[model samples]
Target: MGSSLLPEEFEQAALGLKSGETRRFEISLPADHPDAQLAGKAIQYILTLKKVEQPRYPDIDADFAVSLGIDGGDLERMRAEIKENLERETQRCIRLLLQRQVMDCLLECAALDAPRTLVEQDQRRLAEIARQNMEKQGARNHNAPISAEMFKERAERRIKLGLICAELIQQHDLQAQPEQVRAAVETLSKSYQAPQEIVRWYYADTQRLAEVEAEVAERNIIDFVLSKAKVEQQPMSFEALAKASQSLFTICDKRPEAKEGPPER
Candidate 1:
């Protein structure tokens, strides 16, 4: 059995451990340490648990149906719906995965250092978003606030990804058509009781219409990317795919006063 050790004790234990034996230690860096770059100038983390168990899922059948508040017959219908949804979700996931791979390839092929100022600007934007989200959720900080240096790193990565994606979109000449936008709107309407009313609401606002159009453009780009790349299809139950896709692609209702710009990711 393993014994728990405090940071100071762990450091001592590490000194005596055999070459092949596992060991751990905890250490603190001063705020003025050479490596310190952020405003707060210090960070800390606790590490433990060398191994963890993975949970196994039980079989999905009649029992699962009852648990989900439906009879077996109704469950069959629900399963079908879920499968359809999952298929859509998997496709989207696969598309995102492919995009990341493509971006990585491009970044490697053409290595370049971006301007630090631009990166910092993007970092500030992201930090503002994070701050807003934390405030909205009413979370209390038991530790120091987020730092500019930390956010700058995150912002740089986002800027890099955005530039790569933009280049790819332009290079491929991918554009969303009016018909595609109409079809997307029609598909969105099916979920509402009054499909026409939903359609009207979407069309009545120019911003909302533009948001839908952007979505259509994104879908078009995904389709184009998939066509260029190799895809391996694995057989998934329709119920699983439908549920997954619905969760992936489900659009939220626009606030009455919300002025839409490009569709959100």
Candidate 2:
């Protein structure tokens, strides 16, 4: 785990224990942790060791490619596809980070009080989406753990930013370019069964076109904020970007999965 992922005084801590040994310790979290609910909390952590062994991965051969149903068992094409997917994901992360930066600037400049009705509506909508996502992930809970009240702060911020974006779009006469809209449609339709048909569907409906227009308008606002703000350039390695975006879900992974595994022999 990276330093950011580990609690203070836990990173690279010595755990001098043989295989099959167990240890328990206390973890202290900082007040400004990403999970605000867990801030300043003390957690008891237990480490247990099962049989530790190094991981063995299969070779990158035609049989592997054929099993994955890609490039007709061509290794080079498989590599190319993997690279393309990674680059696309990295580009998405860059856009999200840029959006956050722009939002922070805009929020600092504007004083906003989101309408109570809109905020309540947004809170309900967000709660519903969370419930749906949890259900999709095979959660068997009859009721969602999150309440609409839990979404109030986020909903208020979201509505306020939306109002600001709408004002910026109207005051500046911002229009979504046709080419940009088409590009967006193309990007969104790539994963569908029939991409061309999906593209046509987006263009065929005026309501959908308005949705796309709003997306482009929001992007324009981001660009406008970036242009006005004092921006600094920092070069980042591809490895760093990938690491920054990596998610480790301990959902049925190995006990000593690549971390405190078998001693090197």
Candidate 3:
């Protein structure tokens, strides 16, 4: 958005030029200028103004604070709460990064065959989840057909990782402490309005507690792996940690094969 009719020096410099005022400047384009072929060119320019406008912003007052869910319009309290929330998020991301690294390392080291039956069971489970998602979206083809092989590889990977975690848990005699489970439950319910009721709902169900315990056990396995593995302390910022892709486990087949290895479809 430049005017060719006016020289570049005038430059539409409106920020300094106030309302109801006009000014002019001149510029000489050198021979090396992009538009100049061989010789320099001189030109003159004029400036004109119609009006000036300044942006209007709402003041950071009580009303503004209340709109943002801050209580009593205490800006200091808001800052403290924001800082605490960001710290929690940073901790969560660090855990995710460590867990991802541990899982990938264990998957590469653990050599185990994925059972066909277990893989098939997980395939059905994943397929059911997909159908349920479609139903939630109010789709007519909620139970639409899908390729059976679609979830096979993913199921196999998940099953293999589960098997490895199970083995590690038994070998290490790892226990998901009651306090850890309670902490997990509290973290899960913190964002809800009725956090106590949410916590009660989880505590009332033994099956749900068992699920949390299983997750804790897996996390303990990650900790155990980190303890013995050659450790390196690399510092990372919260933004980097949050933006990182928390990768799940995968394995590459380096198995010896006859003839040629075919590309997977």
Model 1 lowest lDDT segment of ten: 248-257
Tell me model 2's lDDT, rounded to 2 decimals: 0.66
Best to worst by TM-score, what's the order? 2, 3, 1
lDDT of 2 by residue, 13-108 (tens): 424556777777787876644332345789777776555556689888999998766757999987886787778877766665677667767777
- Model 2 pairs in collision: none
- Candidate 1 global TM-score: 0.53
CA deviation > 4 Å runs, candidate 2: 1-53, 131-141, 144-146, 189-213, 243-265
User: Where does candidate 2 have its weakest 10-residue lDDT segment?
Assistant: 249-258
lDDT accuracy of residue 49 in candidate 3 = 71
What C-alpha lDDT values do all the predictions have? 0.56, 0.66, 0.66
Q: What are the root-mean-square deviations of the candidates from the true structure over C-alphas? A: 10.8, 9.5, 17.8
TM-score of every prediction relative to native? 0.53, 0.66, 0.65
Cα distance off (Å), candidate 2, residue 194 = 5.9
What's the true lDDT of residue 119 in model 2?
Answer: 84
**1-265, model 1: which lDDT tens digit per residue?**
1322233545565554544566544355544232223334433443454444457886777777666554563667668757765665566565545444544455576566657877788666655555655666687862335555656544555566556556656888666678888888877675444678878888888878988776666555556756777767677664444443442211111111224432321
What ranges in model 1 sit over 4 Å off?
Answer: 1-80, 141-145, 189-197, 230-265
